[model samples]
Target: MRLYWVILCLVYSGSAVSDQKVYRWKDKNGNWVYSDVPKKGSEKVKLSTNMLTMPATDTSILTPNPATPTVTYQAKITAPSDQQTLRENSGSVYVNGLVTPRFANGFQVQLFLNGKATGPKQTTASFALRDVPRGEHKLQMKVFNDKGMLVAQSAVTTFFLHRASLLNR
Candidate 1:
């Protein structure tokens, strides 16, 4: 394997160095061989001088512009208004929220129930909570930037969940 790489290097370098001579011959094992040194029964090989190259890239496009100001976001819970009561036998709740000045790209939303984060962060402003125990709960929505920094948060909205009891069935 080492010999194969050595021969390949010689062949490729020979093409780049036009002044160097390359020789090709078949060894006793019936395998074609390439080398910079000429051997008995070897023939001189001509390599093409043409090579492909790409222009240097402009790095200015990769850097962010410092003049653009960062946007400030405000989040609000639009559904399940504060102090509202929800009735669901399955304890499921649907939450909806909105962001002022439009939600930007690379931003995410997270829902907090009773001061604890629920479910994964999402790009949309809506969330579906399941299997919540019947009782009072606090809900809040927070917005995060691409860097995972907290950008905005909604005022805590208090609500009550009521579920049908089996004894009342």
Candidate 2:
């Protein structure tokens, strides 16, 4: 029994040690090097042969539901974080907010500026505060589903940025 146990332990240890992964690639000058650390000028890497490849399976399990029911959420800037009032010569002002129902790959987000629909309505979206006459202004965001229907609207939040006009005070 003692001899059998020793052999089993050695076999397991050998397998584990052999499973370390290494990267492979050829350098820019067309010489090949196989070091665990990526060489200085290599652009692509091939993984080691000992790495396990998962057996191919039906792909449906990897797909997202197309008819997945849409979800909606309301985001607010919350109290002191919201109110900002600024000046006229500041060129363009930047307004920002955290968007909601973070999509798996952020594939269904949209943004609006000053009540005007801006852009083609994109996912992973952020909007710039632009072309306001200054003094005081409001910022808002609208997030939507892939189907173009309004799914969520952010609370109409306010903020301020001062150009030289207001800063001289």
Candidate 3:
């Protein structure tokens, strides 16, 4: 009987020491946050309240699941033409009116210089090229949904800027 009691104590003690991991991070607003270690900056948090057990009743019944959000389409991209040609070291280049889908919520245009991504710009259906360096500049336009996911990618547009003529110099 004494041996049986000792065995039960050993089993209970073994189960009591289980550990769980969590992570911590700060948001753009500078608030501290915590999540599992797989999350960014999770190493700073000490584990707390690992073995809590709750009655298995439906707590979610009080709160309804949010309806799957629907995304509305907007203009796609590349109006007049998907491609353009320009001169090297030429001042600002213009990429005129790209088409947007009829039902689009908004448009995001990403510009690439040469082959590198410059950045993204938000507009209705048009984008202007500014301060393009001299040489072959490749411009690409991608359209996105209101949720900021790409819906369409326009054909790569190539433009060239010719060296200024001596006559002009």
Candidate 4:
């Protein structure tokens, strides 16, 4: 038993002493050099054995709560169905739109005629436009949140307008 214990201690001590030693010195080029081999002007360097450790992160805070679900908005133009023709002698047009599940407060709707904004943003989806020239035009609607961020957009609706011409009278 004593011989076995002595052999075990010797093995552990030999392993501990086998650690490589580091030496630091300046090379011929005047640059610092570090290596395990000793040189004539090299000095032994003592390195700290303490290791750096980091605490485990709590992933629960990074994950979103499951209770509140995200909402996606959908919008469509309800009036002036695509490719529809209208007869408006006074050059007036009425546009209407719908948003799925309704939008929250502070959200506004904007009308686009021929790819151009026709009027200021309004809370309702309805719009009354006047002096619309007679011809084909495209209309679209967009919904914006309180911060002016676009939430939803309707597909382009194409329509034609006709008005009485004095030459035809």
What would the per-residue lDDT of candidate 1 be over residues 51-149, giving only the tens digit for each residue? 667999999989999999988889999989999999998999999999997888999999999999998899999999999999999999999989999
RMSD values for the candidates in order, in angstroms, are 8.4, 20.0, 18.4, 11.3
Clashing residue pairs in candidate 2 (N, C-alpha, C atoms within 3 angstroms): 84-159, 84-160, 85-160
Off by over 4 Å in 1: 1-69, 167-169
Tens digit per residue, CA lDDT, model 4, 63-162: 8899988889999999999999999999999999999869999999999999999989999999999999999999999999999999999999999999
lDDT of each: 0.93, 0.61, 0.60, 0.93
Order the numbered candidates by TM-score, best leading: 4, 1, 2, 3
Runs of candidate 2 with Cα error greater than 4 angstroms are 1-70, 76-80, 86-88, 104-107, 165-169
Tens-place lDDT per residue, model 2, 1-169, is 9999999998888787666555567767977777666656654454454746799889997889899986666644433246756554745765455655564444455555556665666664455545656455566667665566666777776666556654567
Error of 4 at 58 (Å): 14
Worst 10 residues of 2 by lDDT: 72-81
Residue pair clashes in candidate 1: none
Per-residue alpha-carbon lDDT of model 3 for 97-145, expressed as tens digits? 3544453556465655566765655664455666665566566666665
Q: Report backbone clashes per prediction.
A: 0, 3, 27, 0
TM-score of each: 0.59, 0.44, 0.43, 0.61
| Better structure of 1 and 3 per lDDT | 1
Instruction: Identify the candidate with maximal lDDT.
Output: 1
Ranking by lDDT: 1, 4, 2, 3
